[model samples]
Target chain A: MTTDDLIARLTGELKPVPRTAVLRRVAIGLGSSLAASATLMYFWLGMRPDLMTAMETTPFWAKFVYTLSLAIAGAWALKRIAHPLGSIRINLALMGALIVAIGILGFMQLAMAPPEAHYYLLTGHSVSICTLNIVVLSLPLLAGAFWILSGLAPTRLTVAGAAAGLASGAIASLVYSFHCTESGMPFIAIWYTLGVLVPGLIGAIAGRYVLRW
Target chain B: MNPVEARLKELMLASLDGDAKSYGVLLNDLARHLRFYFMRRLADAHKGDADDLVQETLMALHTRRATYEVDRPFTAWLHAIARYKLIDHFRRNRIRATVPLDDAQELFAQDQSDAAADRMDVERLLQSVPAKSRDLIYRTKIEGQSIAEVAQSTGLSEASVKVGVHRGIKAIAAKLKGGADDDR
Candidate 1:
């Protein structure tokens, strides 16, 4: 049909679109998802025995800051990227800077520690379990992210998914930290970061299939 | 810059708020724009598909209207969707639509054709790209060479060649949009 003909037909069939309750959905979705994950972590694994003392330690706070920063950035990016024309370049750059800072701090701590303690710092008390716990805890958040994104029109699906995964993983790491006993700065910098990024990679791969509208 | 754009943005925002009349007008204006946009990019042989793309783009905009950010520039969002529809068309018929060199020459030689003018516009836009990337884009886009073929001819990995071509097109689009500088 001609353009004018198509327009006429479309106009005749036009229906009013309801206002999108995106902001409300985001608040409720993320808030409840985080609460559920936190509750599960609290009851299932229990808080670390020295929870009060850990709160006072700089290392513990460092880990918290690291994960929380990622969580905030990723969440913010996800919100904007729900639009087809949204650009996440700034958020991605900030995230990159955070990684570099963490990496530098990790190496510095390693340098200061004695040679014999190097392996202990690198290996940590919990390697496999920490990563797995972060991934598991991120499930609810990831689901929430998917819910938020799939409801929108994100053209860059892989990037949107990666942002969602990053947010989920970071939030998971923050909750997991309450139960984790590891205080090694280097270990947190390395393994904790990996835990968050692993899900990001998974999200990127799955985005093509899941977010294909 | 123009009142038409400002008017379109207002109509779009109104449409989001359930103003069916404004939505219809907005879609009608967008359809006209898309017809021109698609026609400029497509060859004469594929001119029929321009209307199809316009229809498809409008349908997408209708369904995804809820995602539109009122604060952002409307044209950017509109163009992004239009570009994706164009890309989807190219990908769907890449093998069949890749014009041979001889056919491409004939197609461009006809100065009277709108396709030839569009081709010239594309070339001028692409002049901003570095020499190497321009050649890669020429081979892949105009010559219709596959990524593997381009890679083999240039002795670059298929991945890099693909990236180069993608970046080149993106750069050209950016320039066309009046972006200050090339990021790549």
Candidate 2:
């Protein structure tokens, strides 16, 4: 058949697509995943035994603010990176700034404290499992993000996957804060950032396979 | 930057809003463009097969339209789909002697295979050429720059730029063939 004839036959019985369907679907998926992760945190991990006392400390609030900021920035970056040709330079730069801020906080704490306290501050109580917990908690959020990508058209699969991973990791850390007893700025900054980045690295490697249409 | 591309972009945006008329119009325009695109690449003996490629490409575009990034130029996305169809067509014809065309058809019935990998391999192959020649080849072939423009940018005579690009492409093709042979 001629091209004109084909076009007519194909588009003749078209269904109207909802506007912003991609955005809406992904947003809904992420929201549900976040709720599920929060529930998991509450039950599986349980709120820290000293929740009331911990909240009273400046370090506790600082850690919460850091994770929350990372989560929000990561989520926004994920949405923007969904576009294949869309630039992620700004998003990456914002992440760099957040890391720098954490570094400054760590430096200030080091200068104010004595040498004997440095090691303890750096290790806190959960150095061994801190990063691992972040990755484990991120599983549900990563699955949901992948599901959303499957429904939409993401051109740069590896980058998009990494962005999703970064967002998921940040959300996982935010949830982990409720259960984690670590109070050192140095420990939170170092371990929490690594925890968030591990999934992003994994996503970059696996994105080509999983996110490909 | 072309008017046709701008118009196509507008239609695509409109179609996303549930405008069937705009969608139909965009597809019609694409079909017309694709006919010429495929015809130019196919040999005289296989020219008639361009319509099949066109049909396949159109179906792919329709199915994968949801993945289109709104801010991207529509032509770039359309061209990527077209390039995949062309490569598949060429690969099938090349191995037609041993691979029964019908059997091959069954294997490739789903056209959602990863074209990015192939494109990336081609890019990696291009990197084997030296920097100056590689830049020239990229500008002329991938970026669609005129030989005169490339020469001007690199401060070379148009003749030298043309020769460099031609040799660079030849080198890449030879290396790629060698790699394929090793794989086999």
Best by TM-score: 1
Docking quality (DockQ) of candidate 2? 0.25
Sort candidate 1 into its docking category.
acceptable
- State the TM-score for model 2: 0.67
Docking class of 2: acceptable
User: lDDT of each prediction vs. the true structure?
Assistant: 0.80, 0.78
lDDT of 2 by residue, B133-152 (tens): 89998899889999999889
> Which portions of model 1 show Cα errors greater than 4 Å?
A1-22, B39-52, B89-184
Best by lDDT: 1
Per-candidate clashes come to 0, 1
* Tens digit of per-residue lDDT, candidate 2, span A69-156: 9888888777766643444678778887988898789888988999999998899888999999889889889888888776655656
Q: Relative to the unseen true structure, what is the Cα RMSD of model 2?
A: 15.0
> CA lDDT of A59 in candidate 2?
85
Residue pairs clashing, model 2: A153-B67
Clashes of 1: 0
